[model samples]
Target: MSSETETFSISGPSHLTAIDWKNTYHRRCVVASLVQGVYILERDRQQNRIGSQKALAPLWWNFFHFQLNNMLVDSADHSIFGAIFELKPCLNAPRFVIAFRGTLIESGTRSRDIHLDLKCIVNRLHKSSRFQLAIHSIQETIGLAGASNVWLAGHSLGSAIALLAGKNMTKMGYPLETYLFNSPFVSAPLERIKDQKVKHGIHIASSVVKAGLTVALKCQHKQSKPQQDDPFVVLSYWIPHLFVNPADHISSGYIDYFAHREKMEKIGAGKIEKLATKHTVESLLSGAILDRISEPLHLLPSAELTINKSDSTNFRKAHGIEQWWDPTIHCPSLVYQYRY
Candidate 1:
């Protein structure tokens, strides 16, 4: 993330409201679940549990509708992993999904260590030749062919890269949907200026001092471009439905913040406040999330997320991609709605 992206400069993704509500909700949920599968495989890779061959057997075994098309391993850095898959939601209609894996948490003697360095964000934002070449290679290999709809899905650090990729692809005239879970703030400039943890455990131990240095190096290397021309700015205009657990310290579960709700309220007021005046942004946001996915709001009773109170376990579970998306354990509902 950069100073230019202090606020979401780009809009969200195309609303899924144009489609059927039930199908939309199902699609969003399924996409998120499939994305979780990718994260699982990465975790397996990190733990050295992967056997003789690397396969998406986990995803295939877990999600029947999702078919792995190709595994995208960055040739420059084998550690970076992503995948392209085809999903048949209903009626066997295929939806192409491009997903990126998040940071691998390395188990340590005390706390877990994040494997992917945050500096990658600065490099991605600066459009480093190496990063750009890798992205171009992915595009060439995937070569969006006969794809009626394309979605960019990622969790945590992967979400940051997906945000950049989605915004750029949209600017290039692609109508792409996106789903990000427990996404970290993408602005390096903003993080440096704020000097605060935007997301839980995200401001790397070294980042406190190095963030400024990272920004300075980027500033010196790249010529300034108009803010509007910046992809992140474009991303702010598109409303991508970001699924975050309210208890997720890693993402800071900012969605439950009163200020965040207030901001969302303003966006609804301008567009769909016709439903009711008394509804808070949190409530309507649930509806909007459903609508964007073409699903009518069900307004189900609120549910409690059963997370252990211990710090490490809690953080791990709250930030867990699978736990966050699990309907049985975590359901999207207004905090107030549930309490009352």
Candidate 2:
């Protein structure tokens, strides 16, 4: 990430509160599970994970608000469902998943080695991948005598890999689905091959907020204006702002990006030089990543978000928000509500 970005620009995406000014997505009960991110789930009427100073006062990292615990959570179904990997037993599902970790700390490895390993994230996302299909079966392979794998799902960076798999699945005629990151900081979306694949109906990677809208136009999903359900494609994203909010920064697992978070808090990010989320702003340099579709190369460095001001209650204070956001774009801004 650029030090230039660290100091000044308040993000347009972070300022956002509502996509459709007339309708707030958080108001309607959506079907997302807050298994570990408890605090952020019950946040303000707005999607911004911060509730109140009372709820926020005690923590060392005020912006680090999404709550996940070293505490283990269990599911009783004859299977294992988790953040990194899932193992299902005796389930007669046709597909299996070969999920790979994006980036994890591995002692004694050079940064070069670390970047190479991160490609495993994409390795699992190849389309029509028998290997990916076989990943979910590992659970049954060890536990049950014979259990088939089911569908595949990924969030954020993982979602991008899943999308890659969805495309291959389209060619091979397999059922695939995914939920990718919104404008990932990793790589730009593959467009030409993707745009032409519309009619064949490949497995699609749904979105929390459509990755296309938030990415640099160069990085928009590989398709033209997207439809809600095109298999092998990115999904729709609504509340793009919350993720950029200081509160949602910690939500994505794998703390490598935490370095920027830590730096931003200690040395306040300068003014919002430009909003990266609304359009494609170049991503911070890939800290340690090696991928075919890396997002950094195609970033624009100045994009604008389209938010509705009436929706926001305040202006953001560094150390208060989790993501690096600029206040000028079109969204709910904390500038009005906060004085810190």
The lDDT values for all models are 0.45, 0.26
Worst window of 10 by summed lDDT in candidate 1:
4-13
What lDDT tens digits, residue by residue, belong to model 1 across residues 1-340? 1121111112111222233425545555566555655655555555554552543335421344467676655444444357777755544334567777676543420121142434442232324332364356446534654423566777776665665565556556553566666666322222223333353133232222233433333365453657665433433345455555545554543332323223334554312211221232333344344432111111111212123222334666667665543334535433312111
TM-score of 2: 0.26
* Predicted candidate 2 versus true structure: per-residue lDDT over 48-76, tens digit per residue: 32444323211211122212221111122
How well does candidate 1 score on lDDT at residue 174? Answer: 59
Report each candidate's C-alpha RMSD, comma-separated, in the order given.
15.2, 18.5
Candidate 1: stretches off by over 4 Å: 1-21, 43-56, 60-62, 88-94, 106-116, 120-134, 141-143, 146-148, 186-237, 253-313, 329-340
Tell me how far the alpha carbon of residue 129 in candidate 2 is from the true structure, in angstroms, after superposition. Answer: 12
lDDT of 1: 0.45
Model 2: residue 53 alpha-carbon error in angstroms: 32
